[model samples]
Target: MVMENEEVSFADTVFGFWEDSQVHSVNSSNSSNDEEENYDDEEETFCTKEKNKAFWEEQGQLLQATLCRTSSIETKVRHATKEALGELNASERRCICGQLEVAKAKSCCRNCLDRDIRDRLLSLGFNCYISKSKWNNSPGTPSGEHTYLEVIDTSNSKRGEVKVVIELSFRAEFEMARANEEYNQLIMKLPEVFVGKGERLRVLVKILCSAAKKCMKEKNIHLAPWRKQKYMLAKWLGTYDRSTMETLPRAYTNRPQKPKTSMLTYDLLEKIPGLHCTTAVEVV
Candidate 1:
């Protein structure tokens, strides 16, 4: 009887110890799991904080850059505006095109509107390269002979500068149609040329008309025509759809759809704290 009791007690004690050990093991496992979860949460928080810090820093840099750019643009505009006003005040005689002819002439023709426009651009710190044969090498030359102007930055050297190909029309209707044709041809050819040369091409059309009743007829008739032309150009050149279009079409296409990514990118860029658009053209 004593031996049986001792055996029973030993079995009960062993079973209780085993149960206690299992409970302790479970508690230990739970505590370890909690610590791991806490560590993961801390790690995620650290990563998020670092990302936020980097994003703000990048935004600050972009803001500074944007402000500097705006200041420079404003200065240029002031200078250009002063020069244009001075030219207008100095010129009294009207050319054949009914536009004022400035005094300085590169050639003998005083009645030439193109020359007057060229001179005006020159006064605005652009180098008129229209007369040069070398600069006249445009892909769409024979059918569309456009004037090319180099925007000279006096602050920087002449090695790298903004190159502009311009088509000036004294008449709005004729010019708009012609500009569209010319833009289409150039857009088709420029990509290949850009890829080969690793340079970007910028083209502009300047329409010059008198403020007289016969030419303008209304307060802002020119705005609609100009806006349409620019919109068509943007569409044809693939600038409007490049970022958001799903199916990859040709670079220069008549069909343009708003890109999904482009609006987001534009919004992000606009929200860069101090960024502002200061150029005559929004894209530029």
Candidate 2:
């Protein structure tokens, strides 16, 4: 009996020892899993920080490039404007140079300007004059308006006999109308001279102004400095206040005719018999 009791006690001790060993093994495995999870979390956090840094760097570079481009363009425009002023003629018959603050920048690009100008002129019942020079692309700043020179035919009388050199500083509505009338009158008189009778007739058209605009998908770049100046002049005249605006006494010349040419002024309009320089605005 005692032997059997000893055998039973030994079996109980072996079972208890086996159960304790299994519990210790399970705890060690749990600790190892917790350490691996912490390592993975640290790695993910480091990667997120690096990604944020890269994104900010790219954005900064783009902003800097844009600012540089804007500064460069402004500088060029000012230079171009100053250059235009020096090109005008003193007699006002050979060259036209002037400046004005435009209402807004042009909406069209360089490629579309010729079409726009042609369309605008045609709508006004005048032919579009293609400029003699190509687009000016030199990098220069413009401080003021545009300049132009045109040799126009006013009469058909002698088929190239009577040509007027007209120089205009601005493109105000009144100014454009006046110029167009003068040019049209010259053209009308051309047929009276009997074309093909003798001399060769050639009309010269030139654009002598430059304005700079940025090239972009949404905005077009074909800008005429002459047009801008004209626009500015028109706006200025409309808003002119005698209290603040200065005026110069201008000596006006009579519309030149072959037999009779006279120097007249606005003050002398009432005293002069056929020399009144007043005419109604007529659209041709």
Candidate 3:
């Protein structure tokens, strides 16, 4: 009985040593895995920080370039204005027909207004076409649908070419509504006109109001600096405003077009053979 008890005690000691060795091995493996995980996390964090820093640095460089370009443009405009002012007669500042007050009270002739706008845009390095037929609506479609000017950027070849459809209005309330309607129609028709052409289109609504303050107050409309859409509405006291001309290029350059969508029709669906419609009224 004593020898049996001694053997059982010896067996228990061997089993306990084996169990302790197994536990020590597991703990060492766990510590190594924890260190690996911590090292990987720190590496990933360093990479993320480096990427964010590079992105912000690129953005800062772009902003600085834009500011330098804007400053250069302002200097050019100042010089141009000085030269233009030197050439203008006192009489030219007033109306040409000795009806300066009358012209101010009532808007000038469309031809005169268009000519002045074209001249200013040309000075700003834009190629302008007056009463351009390229922007006319389809024949017999609408008489009132027309664009006043088709302007293109002529200065920056690296920026690609930009096409702008400008509509001018002389009347206060009537012109604003007309401009909005025209812009909406142009937005709808642009995709069809420029399909596969890879060209971008922008619309500008230029309203000339005799009483700018009264008109703006009565209409309760404010011009937004920028919108998500490719069109802009601007009110000018006369043929052109310096601020408007300066900001106009940004409207079209580097601006992406809105996504195109097709209007579903029964004829379109009929093009697909073996397709059947269950109901008399179709739902898309």
Candidate 4:
């Protein structure tokens, strides 16, 4: 009996010890798993933060580059505008086409106008070239009243582009022609005016040529023959779709729409007898 009891007690004690050890092992495993889980969570959070930071950095760089480019372009445009204004200030006024303003009479003339226009165009960094022969006066036409100017397009040399001659002729065409002739003669007399590289005579010549052509075109008018009369009636006309160009390489067609005709219709000085007018007698 004693031995059986002792054996039973020993077995119970061993079983109890085994159960305690298993419980401890389970607790240790759970603690280890929790630690690993916390570590993983921390690592994931760090990675997400790093990715977000890198993305924002890249975006910032892109934004900075965009702003820099915009600023540079704006600066260039501002500089160009200022330079053009400066040239304008230096230019002397002359009666190229407009009525001779008495205020500018002594300061302005054909020579001054030509130089001012050329200088303004050149300051903008354009390559100017003039043709060998200048534009001629076309009498008895819309263009008859304007001075002509032609300029070469150095920007698009591949297209062999030439600026349309501008004509300025609101005032008197004859007066403009005489002034131009005098100016040309004066320029020809000055070797430094057109033959020197330092003076940029080539560029000036081109600018002048182009200006002359444009002025001519602007002053050009279409004239129609009067009934049985040798003289023709004049009317202003245009070839461009718009007053100012919005885009380059203008679309041109040989068959263009004609401008609307303008004429005064005289219908007996009165529309239908004015319902019996009151008569006043003049005493002789």
Rank the models by TM-score, top first: 1, 3, 4, 2
Model 2 regions more than 4 Å off: 1-11, 70-74, 77-284
User: How many pairs collide in each candidate, listed in order?
Assistant: 2, 31, 0, 29
Cα-based RMSD of candidate 1: 28.1
Report the C-alpha lDDT of model 1 over 33-134, residue by residue, as the tens digit.
999999999999999768745644544444334323323533553355345435544554333333433233222232253344455656556554333212
- TM-score-wise, the better of 2 and 4 is 4
Residue 79 miss distance in model 3 (angstroms): 7.0
Q: What lDDT does candidate 2 reach at residue 214?
A: 15
Model 1 regions lying over 4 Å from their true place: 1-7, 62-284
TM-scores for the candidates = 0.30, 0.25, 0.30, 0.28
Per-residue CA lDDT of candidate 4, range 188-275, in tens?
3222211122113223333333333433444462223221011111111222221211122211122344766444664543767655
Worst 10 residues of 1 by lDDT: 189-198
**In candidate 3, which residue pairs clash?**
none
Residue-level lDDT of model 2, residues 24-56, one tens digit each, is 888988988999898889988888667645543
Question: What are the Cα lDDT values of the candidates?
Answer: 0.37, 0.32, 0.40, 0.38
**All candidates: CA RMSD in angstroms?**
28.1, 23.1, 26.6, 26.3
